[model samples]
Target: MPHVTFIEHNGTAHTVEAVIGKSLMEAAVDNSVPGIDADCGGACACATCHVFVAPEWEAKTGTRNEAEVAMLNFAAEVKPNSRLSCQIEITAAHDGLVVHMPDGQH
Candidate 1:
């Protein structure tokens, strides 16, 4: 399992062990990390799972696919590092990954 840290908009951090091959959205939801609603159930159809990938982890997390890019347009406070968590599958390289939530999910 990879350990991921999810930081809330208010600066709280929740570190959780994430299963390999699962999506980050699933990990957050399973661990009860705040701010990741995953409204589309990891289908990449919604932006409720939006997160800002830390600069250091960006390369490892990879670029967003077209569907995720499209969905993020509906998110609030979108930034260059923004990603739909459902699109980021957990991998061994993702250990210690950190993501920040926006003030709110749109």
Candidate 2:
């Protein structure tokens, strides 16, 4: 299992343990975390799962794929670190990863 820390726009943080190999969007939605809708059901078509990767964890999470990059363009308040959570698969190396939800996601 890997732990993911989701930081809300207001700075509230919720840490949840998730199974490795599952997408980050699944983990957040399963844990009832606010801000991640995962409206497209883990597909790259929707940007509802958009999140900002924490600066320190950016490298670990890696860059977005072409599909994610295109979808992110439609996400609210997109930033350089923006990523679609559905595209982020959890792994042992991703343990303790932190991400921030955008205010508009609600």
Candidate 3:
């Protein structure tokens, strides 16, 4: 399992153990982490799972696919580091990934 860190808008951080091969959105929702709604259920239709990938972890997480990029256009407070959690697949390389949730996601 990989350990994922989710940083909240209030500067709170929650770390959860996520199983590899599952989507980041799935892990967050399963752990009851605040901020990721995943309203589209891992499909690229919704941006409720929007998150900001930590600067240092960006390369490890990789760039967004075309579908995710399009969906992000509808997300609030989009940034250079913005990503949809449903689009991120957990892997060994993402063992310590950290993502920051936007204030509005809650």
**Candidate 1 colliding pairs:** none
Quote the positional error of residue 87 for candidate 3 in Å. Answer: 0.6
The C-alpha lDDT values of all candidates are: 0.93, 0.89, 0.89
Model 3 poorest ten-residue lDDT run: 97-106
Please write out the lDDT profile of model 3 over residues 1-106, one tens digit for every residue.
Answer: 8899999889999999988999999889999998888888888798999999999999888899999888888777999999999888999998889999997852
Off-target runs (Cα >4 Å) in candidate 1 are none
Off by over 4 Å in 3: none
Higher-TM-score candidate of 1 and 2: 1
Q: How accurate is candidate 1 locally (lDDT)?
A: 0.93
- C-alpha lDDT of candidate 2 relative to the true structure: 0.89
Candidate 2 lDDT by residue in tens digits, 1-106: 8899999989999999977989989889999998888878988998999899989998888899999988888776998999999898899999999999998652
The best candidate by TM-score is 1
Candidate 1 lDDT, 70-106, residue by residue in tens: 8888776989999999999999999999999999988
Model 1 residue 63 CA deviation (Å) reads 0.3
Model 2 TM-score relative to the real fold:
0.95
TM-score of every candidate: 0.98, 0.95, 0.95
lDDT of 3: 0.89
The prediction achieving the highest lDDT against the true structure is 1
